[model samples]
Target chain A: MQKQVEIIKANGEREFFDEGKLRASLLRAGAEDSQVEAVLRHISKELEDGMTTDHIYRHAFSVLKDVQNPRAIRRYSLRRALIDLGPTGFPFERFLAKLFASQGFEVKNDQILQGRCVPHEVDLVAYNENKLVMVESKFHNRMGEKSDVKVALYVKARFDDLSEQLFDYGKARPLDEGWLVTNTKFTENAIKFGVCAGLKMVGWNYPEKGSMRDLIEDSRLHPVTCLPSLTKEERELLLNNDMVLCSQILDSQSKLIELGIKREKVTTIAAEAEALCGR
Target chain B: MQKQVEIIKANGEREFFDEGKLRASLLRAGAEDSQVEAVLRHISKELEDGMTTDHIYRHAFSVLKDVQNPRAIRRYSLRRALIDLGPTGFPFERFLAKLFASQGFEVKNDQILQGRCVPHEVDLVAYNENKLVMVESKFHNRMGEKSDVKVALYVKARFDDLSEQLFDYGKARPLDEGWLVTNTKFTENAIKFGVCAGLKMVGWNYPEKGSMRDLIEDSRLHPVTCLPSLTKEERELLLNNDMVLCSQILDSQSKLIELGIKREKVTTIAAEAEALCGR
Candidate 1:
């Protein structure tokens, strides 16, 4: 019998290390099976009792950087990049709008929708012929900050208020769904409340099938911050110009030229963005 | 017409000074009309454009300390004293339970009640023959921190959940009402949402009637921390021992003795507490 190794999580909780969870995260980042096995082998050699998940992530990231394509390496850094889209949180909302847009929904960011009692400035409102969804984005710049039950509860109430009133998008209709999206995880009670209240929620890694990560990957709407070719300031500038996704950069070549990027540097960035999104 | 004097509020917004508001606050502290006039006169003499409300409060508090009874002085310091009860926030909950109990309600603190879908650990639940109310206390240690719409929304949801299940509190009954109480103020939107959602809310100075301040004053449930006789540590010790109300200390002399107070000092403390509560 093998002894289970203990590891410290980012939120200061200690739990037994799970090899399957690590392998799954690696595989989700599009790492090849052979590369994942090598990474796992190296991780097992370095694993010790009371090691932090941060330490594990850094080790895995370094291994992936060495063995994988820039695309996969960028994908591996998705969580960190999502967090890096913050400090203002506007970019994350724009990113969400784009994510929904990619799924055949006409999205509007920061719309003032009239509720039954008061006006609510919803973060993103996405609608199609079939459904209208109101999303509230809870963006936390710091790690380990989970969207709690209060956020879920308030979002439910806000959506309920809006559901009582009809709004004209393509035609006059009530809100079909309310969604709570965050760049972090949701607390257990928050998830429970969301389920009981019949509100849709998407966090960084919640709900087995379709989380924020799954949706982002499925939509291929990678944030520009994930591009290794651009510096931090360059990425922020693009975000400030409302170009959040990698696809937006491909569409807006003039934004880079306006940001004073040389033609050759622009080509490199465009190529990196294209490769990162596998476009 | 004379230009209105601009005053900076605690939350950093500038507004024209209203002497009537200041006068009402002084009167609420049980200040006599003559004493109130004197305070107002002094305040007016020293008033400057762009003076913070904090400065006005200090001026009023200083005057009240000079001319008012110990009870009035304590009431004048009530808001600050409430904020002082925190950093841990348990004392505030205990204080609230006592406040409700003083009104002939059977109050329990930190009870895990079964909701429709999950169990919720409510802060204070107060029940009488006619009414059962669940309270969620938002205790902020910092000034200018208000219990916002999110809090009211969650409390309403939580209470609604509990409303689905009957509780054995004297008799089997569902929750009759949900109240959101704060030691501070409520944001405008929070108040609107609370009203729209049918959630009863009590803040330090809200509703124009029957607020937390009104209830505290009417009940004379002055917290032990408001007693000028006790040192900060001694007050904390009482709070730690669950002797939140000054009336509790009056009922339990042994607690002071256990806290290592001398006989004469105990007499002084008791007398001060008694005078502070006018009991």
Candidate 2:
């Protein structure tokens, strides 16, 4: 019989280390069976009582990096790269706008639309011929932070205010849907309020289907920050230039050259981005 | 004619320094006409362009302190003392609870009551025979920080949730009214939404007639931190023991004695508190 080791989560809850869960996640990241087993063995050996899940994640990421699996590393680093878009959260909003635009919706960012009671500066507004959606992106820079019910309560109120107000998006139309999107998880109560109020919510791993991760994966719209070949400064420069996706880098190699990267290095970086995004 | 000097406000707005406004505020704080003139002379001599209103305030506070008017000093420092109660804002909540309790309302702090769709941890709940009020205290430690429209919108939603939900507060009753209280100011849009939504609001200097300052002055429920005689550490010690009001010190002299304060110092502090609160 093996002794189960308890590990602390990012939100400070304790649970037994589930080797099966780790194996499944690695496999989902497209790791080979041998690579998955090796990673699990390494994690088990390093496991200790009262260790944090954040530490375990960093350890697993490092092992994957050492195994030279660029695609797996890119997939594993998706959530963290989203967090790197913040401190101001403006980049995350732009990222979401681009993500939606790729999905065949016309998107606008930082729009000040009049509500029934007052005006609101909505983060992202996406519309098609069929539907117009208003979104509020709740960005958290820290790892363990979750958007609580108070946020949902306020977002629902904002949505309610804009529900009957006509806005000119090609034509005068009322808001068909409202969304509260986050780069992190939503608290359980937040999800409950969102559901009860009929306000659509999209979190990092929430709703089981059509989550933020699912949308990004489905559209192959991984952010430029997910590229291992680019340094932090390079990624920030790209984001500042309004280039969010790896596909954007492939389209505009001149952005890299303008940032003072050598021709050979730019080619190498674009090659990695191409492979990561399956371009 | 003296040239009007433009000074920066805490919120970055530039305005001409108004001597009449300064004189009126000093008189309102109980300064004598002579003291007010003396302070005005000092301020005029030291005035410069582009100086911040915050700098003007500190200079005025120092000049008032030098005049050795204890009551006037306590009253002048009242707004600042409320700001010093924060960082966490819990003390501000407790302080508001104490203020409501003084006004013949049975008050409860930090109550988790069931709402229509979810539960909310209300800051203060106050009730009497005729009216039951749910109060949310928006505390901002930073100077010039205001509760924006988003805060008002969310608070209205929370109040709407608890409107029809019956709760046992001595007896089964639904909420009668909802109040938003802040130790600072509310944005203009917030006030607009609050008025339109019929959510009662109280801010430091809002509503003109029944603001937070008026309530505090009416009840003479000055926080212990307003006393210039007590050192910062002593004030914090008193507050940590749940002694919120200066009047509380007069009733419980043993609390001061237990903190190892000398008999004469305790007498001096209490006398200042007594003079400040008129108890």
Candidate 3:
């Protein structure tokens, strides 16, 4: 009987603690007490037997996203939520920027908008051989009709905000193309909207059999900005600093690589380190 | 947009209709409407996005097991609920009984005990060479401490309510055992009480792997009685009269097999069928 009770207590406590762990994760991600409480309450009310912790995290994130200014919460919360949603949207955007750089397109994230009402963070801005492409991403189980309208708005924003002078004067050109990427089948209305807006819609389906990651790689985006110059003494000091930083970064990268994080992402970190240290 | 909306609407409506599938399953199994409705309400309130239709059925059935005298409800309601829960439990029990037969135990289900002040049906009964096991089964996440007391009381009543002759004869022979089986773990205090009362406690975490099906297989309890016999000609006539019914049963068995339902369960069903047909 003691053994039986111990087993039961252990099982119950494990369940209770698992929920607590999720709550702690949310807190660590800087969720407000009220938001955390609300999420936990919703979860408790809806919980049935056999629910996985991952399912709870996804559900909580969805609920949080529905609330206003969810991004103001901890950076990790947003990242964890994106991860829980799988490789899409913001995560995919970051992933694409790195993949494009590795493949050779001059890629920039959070590129400055010169004429916008406010400084806006565009997902990705890629320049290759005087041609520029602006890309936006949407992740959903299935793309609805409204998605096309949303993407069209993004394209219009990009075309209106970026510098037009770059196209004719500088080696780099003003963005001439727009891309909208999604994980599910797009509605016909969305397809027509994309065509009318002069934006390419990349949908992952059985026939296409490609993810946003693949498209980003194919774009061949790389970093084109030149590194700052340094004198001999300054360069030597910087090189020493860079070596130390690079080793540290490499150690972390090695761990990530061992954990099966994409090699392209690790390579991007290495490139950034190399540029900093004049390697 | 219209096509996408149409598909979403269609799938949404289909899910709505299928939502009551568990109620249909219960009604088919002789459960009452009020009982099934109460269970379904508990289930519907717990629904989450991306949950499968089959999950709802299993959940409803698990909840239904806690409701006493489920078959006392209106026949229509019972049938509806059974349909909702799926038509697997009864056959599963039969298979479990057969699997345990070789181990010298006679397993019985839905056995009414009028000896007590309030008549009730036992979910399972196993008579071994040396012991008579009275078993109650509840399929859910966690059985509360009170539920443990209830099982203990039931076991005590069952033992005490036996005829004096039978009790004396059994006493002269060997001691009988009682068991309470649940999908969830028991409270520590409850286990102590059960152990003190000499009743065996079985939970989801039994047999090291927390699978209910596995526990039934490992327990080695069998059916003491066979199905009612039918002549060969009568069996043939019945099969011919309801070929669709026969096929449906076969299909259900095949589906169970596909789901990795225990082989012992399937064999029990086959044995019961053979007995029913006197084959």
Candidate 4:
């Protein structure tokens, strides 16, 4: 076997290089199995000692760009798309709520509930008849600021605070689970504790199979901010109205013109949104 | 004019006292003109330079307790009733929500919202077709701990954050007003700042006439904890079930039995509740 290599993380943490993990991420971005393998092998041999993961990602992104269309490239940048959703990240939380709402979960944004020790403000709560899920959105304006294990731990503690109230109060069955969501990636230990603690988590690419990126792609409820057809001002229009998904634009297609998007361009915006949401 | 006598506040701040405000309070508490006048004249004669408001309040509470009934006394101890309603003040927030709900406003509690400067957690949001109201409940376990002017300042800043979004989105008209509610009292500066800033406030006795105490009395929503007939455990049962208003118990009178109050005592509890809510 070749000598094991180490990669530095965005937060200056170091870990052993894992080719399998990198390959999985690329495949999730719509790379074919053959393409993912080939790119990982090529990138592996070219990797420098103590290379940061950002360099590795950039190298891969550049290679992927050559093979993918602008649209594919756009979807592949789901991580950046989410980060671009907001300067405040409230828009991103709205986007996540829409995704759950699409899945038949009733959602409330920004629920402040009493925790055992002190008052806790939760980012979102989604529920149906059987399950309640609390979401804590750790939004860092900068993409590199990952939601670490510390975030997961604190969320679990907060969830613990209200878990009892769920059963005792009106129609509050115990929460199905607490979800720690982030626009960026999670630290490895965050995944470790969360998996062990059974706190559901979603982030850029934490869980190998059903990560945040994978979930968005599978759901087709991409944040409206991700639509290439929209300008920053138009995106702001959607955001200010708490419209998160491209699908929302499709549902209220007429809202485009009402939003000062020109009458003729409404069709263009709708077509783009329909294509992005895969409807 | 009694030379605008000064009273030392709980926080050791001294401010000029107004007797008109005091008389209005006593009259609102259901005291007759002759009684209120007599007490004011008597209490005014004894007013010393720098008497803390706490001492003055005790004197008033004792005097008022004499004229009020056992049930009225229970209702009058709004501060203790609120504290007794909670291991956490979730019940008080629920009570405030119910107060609005009864007024034909749709209510949601613990609404997490993004403010301009940061994320703000509002206690309740009540709205209807014509207007929206955001409520921030300041619950203190101790009676002397008041919601100060600093709270009003911060809440005003948070309201500025989402005020614009209301007009832009889903059935949201701009909030008609933002209300700061407390189980206890407001500092003089808090009332002044809130009034000047156009932030409406309801506290134990801040607004004198239609104060939080008066609201509960007029709405007939006495805290379940205020019932002297029930034991601590039964009160806990009521609090655990989100039962704050005495009116709620009258609707589900059988619940008193379900909660382990004696079957015979069920009628007793019901009568007390009905009389308190005037149902």
Q: Name the candidate that leads on lDDT.
A: 2
Candidate 3, Cα interface RMSD: 31.9
lDDT tens readout by residue for model 2, B1-279:
344999987557799988886666556545788887888888888899998775675476457556757555565589888987866788888899899888889999999989889999999999988788899999998758999998998998898888889878768898998999999899999999898889998999888998988898888998887765566787678778888788888898778888877654565556556556744
Q: What fraction of the true Cα-Cα contacts (under 8 Å, chains A to B) does candidate 2 also have?
A: 0.83
Best by DockQ: 2
TM-score of chain A of each: 0.73, 0.75, 0.41, 0.70
Q: Which structure among the candidates has the greatest TM-score?
A: 2
TM-score, per-candidate, Cα-based:
0.74, 0.76, 0.24, 0.39
RMSD per model, one decimal: 15.5, 15.3, 33.1, 21.9
User: Candidate 1 — which pairs collide?
Assistant: none
Q: Give the better candidate number (1 or 3) by lDDT.
A: 1
Instruction: Rate residue A213 of model 1 by lDDT.
Output: 84
Interface RMSD, in order shown: 1.5, 0.8, 31.9, 13.7
Ranked by TM-score, top first: 2, 1, 4, 3
Q: Candidate 3, A248: how far from true, in Å?
A: 16
Clashing pairs in 4: A110-B112
Chain A TM-score, candidate 3? 0.41
Cα lDDT tens digits, model 4, B36-71, are 766676677778888766556446534644554635
- The C-alpha local distance difference test score for the whole of candidate 2 amounts to 0.81
Error of 1 at A264 (Å): 5.7
